[model samples]
Target: MRKIAASLAVLVATTTPASAQNAVDWFGVDGLEFASPATSFRFTDLDLRDPHVFLPITIAPFPTICFDFTDNAIPTTTVSFNGNIQASYNSDSSPADGFLDASSLLWFRPLAQDGRVARVDNGGADCLAPAPTSGCAPSATAVATAYAYASFAAGTCLSSLPGTQGSPAYAPAIASPAGSCFVTAPKTFVFDNNGTPLTLIDAQIAASFNGVPATALSNGLLRGFLRESDANQIVISDPALPGGSVTLAGPAGRRQRQLFHAQRQGHAPGRERLVVLFQLQRVPGDLHRPLSAFGDHVRFTEDTR
Candidate 1:
């Protein structure tokens, strides 16, 4: 009788938990559901300042419709409002079963002609003419916007793994910047991961003010990087130049360049966390300007964080 009781106890301990409601239930809340949730992130974004203030070339460098003078000049650009962001989490007795969704709106304006820096008259300008005020206006601006979205998920299935090893992340619908600068209707970038990890594949910016394709921009004004690890840092590999890394910090810290790495470890049972850190390049005076070199432009290295 004693032996039987002990056996029964063991069976109950193992099966009872499985029989009860699953404690690992994780539900995915759609972006629509979070339309009103209080956003909880910092926006010390310098990109929002006057585009010329963060100039890669010189101070008060007049804005131009075309970047004919130097490569570091700020292009007249703007990004519209932020779009809906949604995140969902789920946990099953499986190897992979989680997802993340995020979306937003962004826009840009590139100067192609002179007088573009100065305010224009009531009459619009053309985008191509050296003084293109006639044919579409040389200082003319192009506007493009579209609903963009992304999704991510993880689960036990072969395709549930998180990373680029599986099907590539969904591509963003490309938009062309007008020959000048233009704004589009509010758009959103939606991210969904049905049941696998979603990886960002690419990002691009155009060189010309014309409404050229995104491929052309990839070679000119675009720079991007992949989320190496949750270390809160990532390396940007600009197709036009060499690759570099970025790190975020609390207050004042030496900016670490080139030398960096990310370390991460966690499981599906709880929230995932990542931190980034770096040592600043010790210099005499502040590195207000970057060293002279093709990829050495410090503007690119300016810590936006």
Candidate 2:
């Protein structure tokens, strides 16, 4: 009996799928867009002329990369490209600890109006159009499938579970017209002959604001983007960094109005609060052009540092 049980256990172990052993699920929106550019509000600025940027974000929490999953009849509706799973999550959006917290799922083509999660699957169903050769996803190597991002704000009320959304010292998706910290510093720069930036620094760092006082640093509204120090919204290749070097540049993402975002919060007297509108990411071209990823609606967490 022991021998037989041992053999069965080995068979069961071999037959079990690898995914069954995992516990972590990774789905973070690496970069987001919120509002139109400076030239927005014009009727003609339909955002149709820009090249779409589909960034494949990778989070280290889970072993596998984040992919799309549609559970039926839940508030997590990341529906699209048509297999059209009937699922939804309770997208009752509101602020939690000053930041935008909700259950909005993301889908390509139409922007998300509810839910908190954003998902991306390898596009496949687009090939199943009436013409048979729809050239979508797997059928075509490169498909310009545009997706709608989550829109949030510095919500007035708190979410049901305010404790879950962990408040970090430095949070993102927040900016301000008041401090204009980014405008005052020399954060943005052009690429030199060696494919390296002339000067790259963070907008949030204290030293960047050389003339500003400690009271301002301690109490001012700052750009909450964690990567603003090196990787701005308009990402590019830098030879100086270990893996940021860009050998060949591809077509740039729509530089105009791809900024999607939401979240903002009040700061403590000696801490930081966010005031930006939202988040956005443009392509790797034109690093010299100053772009701030349109800022952040931001849950402004108090950055103690």
Most lDDT-accurate candidate:
2
**Sliding window of 10 residues with minimal summed lDDT for model 2:** 41-50
lDDT of 2 at 137: 19
Model 1: per-residue Cα lDDT over 8-97, one tens digit each: 110000001112211121133111211111111110110100011111222356542222111132233221111100000011111121
For all predicted structures, in order, the TM-scores are 0.16, 0.16
lDDT string, candidate 2, 113-211, tens digits: 132323111111111112211121121211111111222222211111111112341232222212212111112212122223322222221101112
Model 1 ranges off by over 4 Å: 1-172, 175-204, 207-221, 230-305
Off by over 4 Å in 2: 1-171, 177-305
Indicate the worst ten consecutive residues by lDDT in candidate 1.
Answer: 6-15
Q: What is the lDDT of residue 134 in candidate 2?
A: 16
